[model samples]
Target: MYIPAAFRSDDPDLAWQLVEDIRFGCLISGGLGLMASHLPFMVERGDAVRLVGHVARANPQWKELEASPVLVNFLGPNTHISPSWYTTSPRAPTWNYVAVQVRGRVRVTEDRETLRRMVLDLSALMEPDGSPWEAAKLDIAYIDKLLPGIVGFAIEVDHVDVQLRLSQQNNADDQRKVRAALGAGSLRERQVAETMTRYLGRLPE
Candidate 1:
């Protein structure tokens, strides 16, 4: 992630919030070919940050991980900004966004007990309201039958790159114009615009 100072997000708490908000991530690893898997992840922070997730044991990407490090990308809201929305003279269109990338070594956990715990924790985190569903909802016998089909892994993050480009380079008038235009445009664009509004106050003049 090439983030200029104008678009850098260095706040650790904000970085973790983005990770939690965007639970789904793309896990990429390089080897014989570029391998990628889209998976839901749980962020664990203690002595270090660890990303936990699971995939089908049959996935070829899992087999190739022992040979190299893996990179996980968590993408937040992003939107296209039309040059027409800017207060200044015509400019080339660009994108405004936020994304976090984690680079780490992958370690597969084969232990069924650990995998089961990981699955339960993921479920709880995903449904924090205590809304319905339980780890025990699945028939124990049936779950045992399914457990063998999957494998769990934890990526200990050695490095993280976070980028937040929310029209920070633009003046307040231009930023407001972009936000108002995007907010009324489309669903995705509106969401990004809303995020920009929230973080816009933090940007320097």
Candidate 2:
């Protein structure tokens, strides 16, 4: 979470967007020797924002949520930037990526209703539009039976760190070259390229 001044993203809205856009993230409990769980998260914004998710009840990580400070890490599009792609000489290979880190204390819930609601909301977030399968369609009895096996939790955010390392340190020419190289690569790379254009503004071709 070390962010240089050049790479630091101070925009809260953009950070929230990243968390929502990439809903899947790692929930880490530092109160438990840094134990971690991979989970899908939902952003609850209001007077106080919250990060919500669930884990298997048997997962020991849940015990740590209330006992210690927690962190949620979300990674967006990323790509390797080869030194060869830079217009500037002597530049070493590096990465172009978007990452968000949230730190806070957590609150866990065992209520069946809350768990059910969390599941339904998560399914809606994950499912593509017009998909036939839906959580609401599942039998309530079955859902209730299954709910006992899981635990739902929410993290009240203490702080957030957003890093957008999109070659902001590079000169425009080198950045443009990196963007062009990224544009020619995978979907993720193309996403990085697109972000560069959007955030850094249009440059001379």
lDDT by residue (1-205, candidate 2, tens digit) is: 8988788877788889889887889998877577988999999999988999999999998987899888889988888889999866887878988889999889999998899999888888889998999888888898888899999999999899988888888887888889998999999889999888776542121
Residue runs of model 2 more than 4 Å from their true location after superposition:
201-205
User: CA lDDT, every prediction?
Assistant: 0.85, 0.87
Model 1 Cα lDDT, one tens digit per residue, 71-141: 99989899888999987986999998889998999888879888888877887678757677777586767
Candidate 2, run of 10 with poorest lDDT: 196-205
TM-score of each: 0.92, 0.92
Clashing pairs in 1: none
- How does model 2 score by TM-score? 0.92
